[model samples]
Structure formats: C-alpha cells, structure tokens
Target: MYNRLTLATLASLPKTITRPRYAREALRPGILHIGVGNFHRAHQAVYLNDLFNAGKSHDWALIGAGIRPADRAMRQALEAQDWLTTVVELEPGANTAQVIGSMMGFVPVGEDARAIVNALDDPNLRIVSLTVTEGGYCIDPATGSFNPEHSDIVYDASHLDAPRGVFGALVAALRRRREWGLAPFTVMSCDNIPHNGSVTRDAVAGLAALVDPELAAFVHGSVAFPNSMVDRITPITTDRERTMLTERFGIEDKRPVFCEPFRQWVIEDNFPTGRPALEDVGVTFTPHVAAFELMKLRILNGGHAAIAYPAGLLGIHFVHDAIANPLVRGFLDKLETEEIIPQVPPVPGVDLHDYYRLIASRFANPDVGDTIPRLAQDGSNRQPKFILPVTRDRLESGADVTGLALETALWCRYCAGTTDEGEPFRLDDPNAARLTPAALAAKDDPAVFLNLRDTFGDLADAPQFCSRFGIALKSLWREGTRATLQRYLNDGF
Candidate 1:
C-alpha cells in the first residue's frame, strides 16, 4: 500500500516522482479559477507550480471555484488530499508523475454561489481565469452572441445578490468592487473558442446589461478578458488511472490526472491589476493571440473533432486506438492537408504543416488514455466551433470542402445512435434529443440534419456544401465508414 498524498507525504514520494519545491504555506491566492478540472490542473496549475518552484509569484497561487453540482465532487476529492494532485505524464518511452501544489483552496460549491462571488470580491485576487469548456459561456451558436434569455442568465439577473451561475457571480463581484472603489480583476479565458476573450466579455457584460445598462457599461469598460490558447490532451481519470497511480507511481491520490507529455499556453497580455510572470516559464505573452488561437482551434481542436466521430462510429474507445487505425488516420491527414490547413492563416514563427504533424503525433500517444467519447462529447457545441468555421471559410473562398463534408457526414452518422458494427451508444450531446431525431430522419433526406439552424446555420442553404454533405451522408449509410473513408482517400473529392 502507498501513503496518501499530502504535504507531509511529499517527502515520502519516490525520487522519480517530483513534488513541490516551494513552501506550500507561503503561496498566496491571486487567481480565482472557476473550473478545477483535469485540463486546468495539468495546464494552468502546472505552469504556476513551475513559477512557484522557481521562487516567484508566491502571491499568484490559485483558489479554485465552481458554479455547478459537479464542482462539489471535485472539491471533496481534492480537499481530501489537502488540495494536492498527482499529475501523470504519459509519453511514448517513459511515464512520469508530479504532485502540483499551486491551488491553495476551493470555494464551497453551492446553488446560491455566494462563496464563489465572495471569493471574487477580494481585491488581491487579480486574475479570474476559466476552463469551464466552450459550451459553458451561454452563447447562441446561430447569432454568435450571448443568450441573455437563457433561463440561467434570467435567473441570475433577478438573483444578482445570490447568483447561481459563473457570470452572475462575476457580475455580483464586479458590482461590489465598483461600489467599494477597488480595481476590477482581469477575466482570462483558457477555453478553446476563437476570440474567447471577447466572447467572455459579451457573456459577463451581457448578463450585467440585463441587471442595469450602467453596470454593464462599468463591467465592459473596466474588466479585461484576455484571450488565450491552452493545449494539453488530458483524459478523464477512470479507475484504471487511479490504479496506475498506485501501481506505477506509489501515490494514493484520489484525483490523479493523466495527460500527454506536451502542454502549451499562449496568452494575451492584458491583465490590469498585475499577473504572474508566466513568460519566465515558457508561456508566450503576445498582443495578437488570435492567430495562435485560430491555428490551434482549427488544426488541433478541429482535428480532434474530425477523428472523434469516425472512431466512435467504429466502436473504438481510446483516442490512440482510433488514430492507430490507418484509414481513420488517413482521413484526418487528407482532411487537414487539403481542406483544413489551407484555410488557416500563417501563425508567426510556426509552420502550419509542422504544427499539424505535432497534433497528429500527440493524438497517436497511446499512454494518455484520451477517450474517443471525451472528444465525441459536446458535438453540438464543438462542430460549429471546430468544423463549420473551416467549412465556412472554404465555401466562401470557393474551395472544395469534400473532406470537411465527409467529417460532417460522419458526425451525423455517429449521432444516429449506432455504430457501423450495429452497436448502439447514447449520444452525449446536450442537444441529443434534437440531434438524434434529426439525424435519424436525415437517413431519408440529408437536409433534415442540415436544418439544425442552430448548428449548421446558413451553411445548409449553400448548394456546394449541401450537395457534398448529402452525397457523403448517403454514402456513409450505404457503404459504411470504412469503405466511405477509403473512397475519399482514393478520390481527392
């Protein structure tokens, strides 16, 4: 048996497993991160750990907060171990483990969110970061605007004093800061959405607008939402990972995170009330984070979207196994090289082709336990963000979107709730009820699936894209995924 991970047990950890070098007690809270998930731990928290180990940014430690019922479970898990995380790095040759100690505490998870709002009210908490996923922003896909009419937003508007959601809590805190004559903290977005900073501003300011236009103006004018691109293939931790932590690393941590060896963060330098010197530890602070953001969103994220449905439809479980399939890998290669990469503008000092190669290699890492279902989940939000933007660019440029159309068709086939092998799986999208029936109906007329104006928007009305999508969907229904992918590989169409 292994000792439970805590500050005391840090000294007991094996020499191979790295633990925090700095004094945990000396670390102070400067960031109130809303989400405490694996990606945040593996990416942002890891960066802070590095900065702290270098004996800097002691006051810039993180205080985790959340707005959902699920956050309570995470809090319980992490708090049990004294807010320690055993992050396992899965690589091709060897695996490594580290215990990160940057998070000082978590706000109590509750419906009223008074704890989180109160935490945000502190002036010392200068940066408010988020990894709440792309869908959590309460944005309408069709209009590309914040949906203030959303029930959560509507509820938060009336209950600003005891807001239930993240934005509501932020508005409450900002309102308090304004009245108290304190400077507003920066709102940083680490999620994978294009122009994420601007999107976050709209969500927070839009919600504030509902309460009072003046409050909205104050928030819009004062708060700085910095756009950022964060990359780390962190898979959901299952019992297998927990078992690995015990067997391989000799750490009995309840909330261990398993991720690929590669991690990156590119941030826009816009923090008004001071921030961590993340640039000292490999973080790229830039004025134009958009180019980097777009390149990653299209190539890395879009590539995940491209491979996920095909792997899911083939009944593949792990991401490595899916990419290991020659046909599946070939489909992604062709799609990115011909259609996807062509649409992405040049990112400074980075070759687009080289970046795609790196993405492919990362996906092919077998040890990370990244699941196809993880990538496959949230397609209703993902497709519009990852896949359709490329489709839109290609269509507008009068370029052939044959590979993208095939990718879309694969998503539809996967949504029909069955694999090519006739095994049924529940669609994991939030809009599953609407997507499933539409996908089922599309077997007769492909336009039925395209009519999800919320998803496809006016792209359904384009003849070029529509015809290609219809033909590909029909082919998937008849020839199956394998044959269809082979045909696309053979014919550049």
Candidate 2:
C-alpha cells in the first residue's frame, strides 16, 4: 500500500509522468520548433522521441517557441514538467500512454521579442520547424501569397529592430546568424497547407524581399524549406482528459496530449545543413510529399469541411455523433467516392479506398471527442483549403459538382449568423467581420456575396457554380438545413 501510494503520487505530478530509462543526456540544440501544439506533440515530437529512445540522434532535442500570448500558458505548463508531455493514443479497444521527452526547453515571446530572436540565432540551432497554423504565416488566403501589406507584417517590416511577429522574428534572427557567420537553419514547415514548405518559403522570402532584397536572396539560396504531409487528430485538452489521465493511467500530466492511435508524417528529404534522423522512427522521407499532401488535404480535411457545416446546422455536437447520423455519414461517403475522388490525381501506391476506410475509423474514434465547433471555426479560411480546391478541380474537369456545390451552399448558409432554431449563430473566423456581412447582404443577391474578393475571389464569380450555390442557399433558407440536405440526398445530386 505504501509503494502504491508513492507510485500514485509520482504519477500525479507532471514531471514524473515519463522518466526516460536509457535515453542519453540532452545535447546541443539542433532543432527549434515553433507553434508547439498538440499535433506537433503527437506527430513530430513523437518521431523525435522514438529516435532518442533508440539512441540515434539525442543532439536534436526540441526547443519550443510560440508567438501568441495564449502560448505563454503552454510554455509554463511544459516548463513545469521539464518539457515532458503525456501522449495518449486512443485505439478502439485499448489505450496507451507514453511520456515524450523530446522538448528540451521553451522560449516565450517577450515584449520586445528579443528572446525568441536570440534563440533562433543560436549557432547550435540547426533546423527551425513550424506548425504555426495557415493563418499564422499571414498569407493572403485568396491569393495564397504573403500579405506584405498586412498591418502587422507592415509594422514588423518597418520596425525590424524591434520585431513584433513571427516572420519579423525569423528575419531578425537570420540577420544575426548571418552577422555571426553561422549557417542558416533549415526552415521545415509541418503545417497542413498545400505545398507547405514552398508556402512557408514564399512567406518568409516574400517578407524578406520587401525589407531587403539581398537578405531575401540569401534565404532563397541557402536555407532549405522541406515540404511535409502530417496527419493526426489531436483534440484540444479538456478537464475530462486531465481526469482520465490521472484516473485511468495514473498520470497527472499538466499539459497532457490526447490523440488517435493513427499517425503519419511524410517529409521531403531536403535539410541543407543538418537534421534529426527522424527516418529511423517511421518518418517517411519522400521526394513525392506533394502528392501525399494533396491526398490528405483533399480527402481528410476536405471530408471534415464537407461534414462540419451540415453537422453544425443539424445541431450535432461531437464528430462521432455527426458521423453516426446515417444521413450525414452517407452524404460524406458519396462526396468522397463519387464526387471528390474522381478528380484527385492518383497518389503513387496509395489505395484511395483504403485511405477512405482509415479516415472513417479515425473520425469514429470516440475517445478523440473532437467538437463540431472546433472544426466549424474559421470556415472562411478552411473551406478554400479543404473544400473549394476539390470543388474547383471537379468543375475544371467537367465532372459532376452537385455534391460539391451543395457543400459550398451549406457553408454560406452556416455563415448567415443564425441556426435552424433561430438562435444567433457564432462566426468563429478571423474574417468573420467581412464574411458575415457579405453572407448576410448576399441573402438577396449572392453575386454580391461572391464578390468579396478576399474569401472566394474569382471562384465566387463562376457562373455555373454561382447559380447552383445560389439555388442551394435559397433552398436552405426556405426549407431549413435538414430538409435541404434531405432534398439533395433524395434528388441524388
């Protein structure tokens, strides 16, 4: 009983969650990870942990950093636990918990942003990785280019000495590294954006070009931005997750991460200076990461958007609950197999059917408890990346786009700021102010809504799409979400 009590006490503390058995002592910094969120914890950090556990590359432990104030809480939690995180993998019948110890330390964004830049400029730091969300890069969503004109970016561009944003911090740090004659760290992007490495390269290089052409040329020539395809459904942590960790696993990790059992990370093998031997731990270093990226983005993320708006309108709360609804599930499957898959170019050696099955299983993981609101948030940004790209592909190929058209209309109706019960709906997007107003105003004239050059751009003005989307939106407004979905399903569109 005494031994049991001691074990319980140790398990409850975050610091004692996972004690590395034979892992080597920390080595010099080789990687600087930005936006250390749950996905990074589950995906990249897991790979790094496996490498350390195998005694391969202990020198490359992670140094985590974040740009926003919310990241302060994460930094403090991890620092309290010595940068250890309890990763729980939820399987159908069993669950497993492993404490990941890849992160060595964290640097919070200070008022003047000196600390973050100093960390980045550290000669020991070799690879600078980012899981910063798509929006975090300050890319103009419609154009898929860096928005140098963005107020925050503009401010940072002018005030480079006192950098404010992540891009600014990166440029300042690179400048210091140049001054110190240290080789620039490879910038690897693990975000979900299509061609993420190139996107990040463009964002960084684009910003640098506006400030200093020579610096931009240096980055373009020396630094390697490797594209990657990452997949894992890591739900936001909640009180329930914390309690489960303590009660079920007897681990009290302050910043415990819960994720599905399935995980995938495919990276382009293009680190110029040096990188961790992550390939030793199931990280597929591929030349065809672009194909894999397109497959995941269109299939997984696209499926999420296809189901999210309709599920929200139907009052479904959790992802599993939404999937359990036969109507919603059937609609999603049809969209993938019939409409979406037809346009997706063949990804080498990937069985689309098997991929679809895997997606279904992942979405059905009740342990994840991913919320509809979380998926529904920022539809204005998500739809273009997840839904519209496929829609455009189908339309361009002259394929049937009725299902895709319905998906877009459902999204527009969802943004109208009210539910079927007439309760005020919440618009959870950065572009909410612009998108919501356009959506409301387009209630009578959809062309006006489509004209918001920011969200839809030219895609909104396509004649056939506009007509179909207009019809679907009008039907949804008159008949309600359920009836409109039922009509689309029964009518076999």
Candidate 3:
C-alpha cells in the first residue's frame, strides 16, 4: 500500500532497480544543462545514469537550470525527489522502468542571473548542454540566422548586466570565463535543428560580436558546439502514466518520463575541452552525422509533419489512432517511399526503406500516446525546419514535390482552426493569430498563405510548388481532408 499509494515515503522502491551507487552521493558539478525536460531525462540523463551505475564519471554530474518561471515547478518537483526521475521504455514484448539519478541540483533564473552565471563559470563544468527549443534560439526560421534585432536579443545587447534569454545568459557566462582566463565549455546542442552545432556557434558568436568583437574571436577560437541528432518519442506525461507506475509497476515516482523503446543519439565528434564516454552507452560519435541527421529530419520528422496536420483535421487524438486508419497510414507510406525518399541523399550503411519501415512501426506504437495537437503546435516554426527543407531540395533537384506540396497544403488547412466535424480547434502557436487568418482567407487562393514570408520564405514562389499546392488546397477545401487524401492515394500523386 505504501509503495502503491504514496511517493514521498517509498524507501524500498529505490533498491528494486539497478540504482546508481551514487544515487544518494553528491558529486561535483561537471555539466550545466539548460531545459531539463522529458527528452533530456530519457536521453542524456539516462546516459549519465548508466555511467554512474558503472561507477565511472562520479566526479562529473549534472546541475540543471531553466530560464522560465515554469521551470520553477520542475525544479521544485525534482528537488522533492532528490533530482531523481523514472524512465520507462515501452516495447512490443517488454516494458522496463529505471530510476535516473544524474542531476545533482538545479538553479532558477530570477532577479539576479549571477548564480546561474557563476555555475557556468565553474572550471570543472566542462559541458554546457542545451535542449532549449528551436524558438528559444531566436533564429529566423527562413534564414536560419539569429535575429539580433529581436526584442529580447536587442535588450540583451543593450543591458549586459541583466540578461534575459538563454543566449544572453550563455554570452554573459562565456564572457566571465574569458575574463578569468578559463577555457570555454563545450556547447552541445541537442535540439532538432539542422547543423545545430554550427547554428549554436553562429548564434552565440553573432550575439557576442554585437557586444564585444574580441570576445567573439575568443569564442570562435576556443568554444566547441557539437551538433547532435537525438530521437525518442517521449510524450508529455499524464495522470495515467503516474497511475500505471504506482499501480502496476509499484513505483511511486513524482516526475516519471515515459518513452518508446527506440532511442538514438548521433553526435559530431567535436568536443574541444572534453566529454563523457557517451559512446559506451549507445551514443554514436561520428564525423558524418549530417547524413544521419538529414535522413532522420526528412523521413522521421517530415513524416511526423505529414501525419500531424491530417490527424488534427480528422479528429484524431493520438498518433497510433491516425496510423491505425488505413487511409492515413497508406498516404504516409506512399508519400515516404515515392516522393520523399527519392530526394534524400543516400546514407553510408543505412537502407532508407528499412528506416521508413522502422519509423512506421514506432508511429504505430499505442503506448507512446503522442497527441496530434502537441505535434501540431508551432507549425510556423516546425514546417520550415521539418517539411520545407525537403520541399526546397526536391524543387531544386527537379524531383517530384507533389506530395510535399500537398503536405504543406494540409498544414495550412490544419492552421485554420476547424476540424472535419466542423468543431472549433484551438490553434497552439504564437503566430497562430496571423497564420490562421491568412490560411482561412487563402482557402481559395493558396498563394495568400504561401506568401507568408515568415514561415515559407521565397520557397513560396517556386512555380511548380505553388501550382501543386494550389490544386491540393482547392481539393481539401472542396472535398474535405479524407476525400483529398483518398484522391491523392488513389490517383497516384
């Protein structure tokens, strides 16, 4: 009853699984991670937990910090559990759960940024990892460059003493380290951006150049931002997850993270200062991460975008439900095998067919419970990264972009805030107010929506793309998503 009902007094639960010997032992801070979200827990923290379980890298542990007030809630939850998390991976035949104890402490962004900066200044802290979402970087999606003129960044440039954003905090910390004659920590970006490491380098160096040219040069020479491709379908936690762990698994975890069994982290081998032997725990360190990154971005993520909009429009809730429908699944399969895969560059040892099949299986995993609305959030930021890159490449190569163009049309239609059943759907993006109106007005004129320079950029003007997109939009508006998808599938688009 104690183990099943209450988490606060579970003394025996810690010993049931392979506990890290240092579960209760405090270690020196060696990594200062920003944005300690679920993916971080299931991926990086899981790696660190494995390393700690092996009784290696005890001197190097994690201290998490966050920039938002929402982080305070996470900090409080983690502190209550002594910075521990339970990660459960659901597979076909087996479900496994383990407690992770890699994080030592957390620092909150507050009235004074000194504590966070001081933590980063620690010479022992060799890695400053970030999972701050794509929007957090303030990069212009279309241009893939930092918007120095962004209000927050502009504020950061003017007032160095009081920094607001993550970039601002990072710049302030690096400047302090430089002034103290300390070597810069490796900047590892675990985000889903293309050339994420290079993007980080440019954004950081670009911001630094605005404030101090000399400091920018110093960063350029010393710092290392390693690009990485991280994947795992770890959805937002729910009360059902908590109940399952307590009732079925008999582990009362406060902030448990549930993910699919599949996990992959391909990282660029470019750490200047040093890094953990993450390779020992299934992280592939390679020079050709770009191939893997491109494959994953275009196939897995792109397929996700292809499915999300239609799922949202069809009144589907979870990813598995959408994949269960023959119409949706068939459309996804045809799109990937015929249209998307041809444009993808061949990866060294990987079969693209196998990869797509694997992605399909993962998407069909009912346990993931990945919501359509969650995936549909921030389409403005997501489309340019996940969808349009492939569209742009296909158009440039004179390859078939009919499917890609249709995917974009579906995205625009999804943004209109009305489902197939004529029920009101809430748009979940900051740019939704602008995008929804434009999308609705462009119900007949697809060009009106495509001209969204903020999202599509000049790719909107590509003649072939515009023609296909216009036709798809017209079909969807006239016949609804089901008929449009059925038509495309049957007519062989």
TM-score of each: 0.99, 0.94, 0.96
Model 1 regions lying over 4 Å from their true place: none
* Candidate 2 residue-wise lDDT, 1-493, digit = tens: 2111122244444443454443435545688888988899988888888888787787888899877776788898787766778898888568777777788889975665667888876777888889888777777767767788888678888888888777788888887887789999888898888898898888778778878999999889988899999999988888988888878777667778899988899999998787888887888989999889888998899888888888888888899999998878888998899887776678889998799888987898888889888888888777878888787777787776778888888787778877777777688888888878777777788777777777677787677788888888888888887887787778843
Stretches of candidate 3 above 4 Å error? 2-11, 14-18
What is the TM-score of candidate 3? Answer: 0.96
Positional deviation of residue 347's Cα in model 1 after best superposition, in angstroms: 0.6
Residue 159 miss distance in model 1 (angstroms): 1.3
- Between candidates 2 and 3, name the one with more favorable lDDT: 3
- Model 1: per-residue lDDT, tens digit, 1-493? 6979988788888889999989988988999999999999999999999999999999999999997778999999999899999999999779999999999999999867899878877889999999888899998887678898888899999999899888998999999999899999999988998899999999999999999999999988889998888899999999999998999888999899999999999998898889999999999999879999999999999999999998998899999998999999999999999999999998999999999999999998988879999999999999999999899998998999999999999999999999999899989989999999999999999999999998889998999999999999999999999999999999844
Each model's Cα RMSD: 0.9, 2.7, 1.8
- Taking all chains together, the TM-score of candidate 2 against the true structure is 0.94
Model 3, C-alpha of 181: deviation from truth (Å): 0.7
Which 10 consecutive residues of model 1 have the lowest summed lDDT?
Answer: 142-151
Identify the runs in model 2 with alpha carbons over 4 angstroms from their true place: 1-19
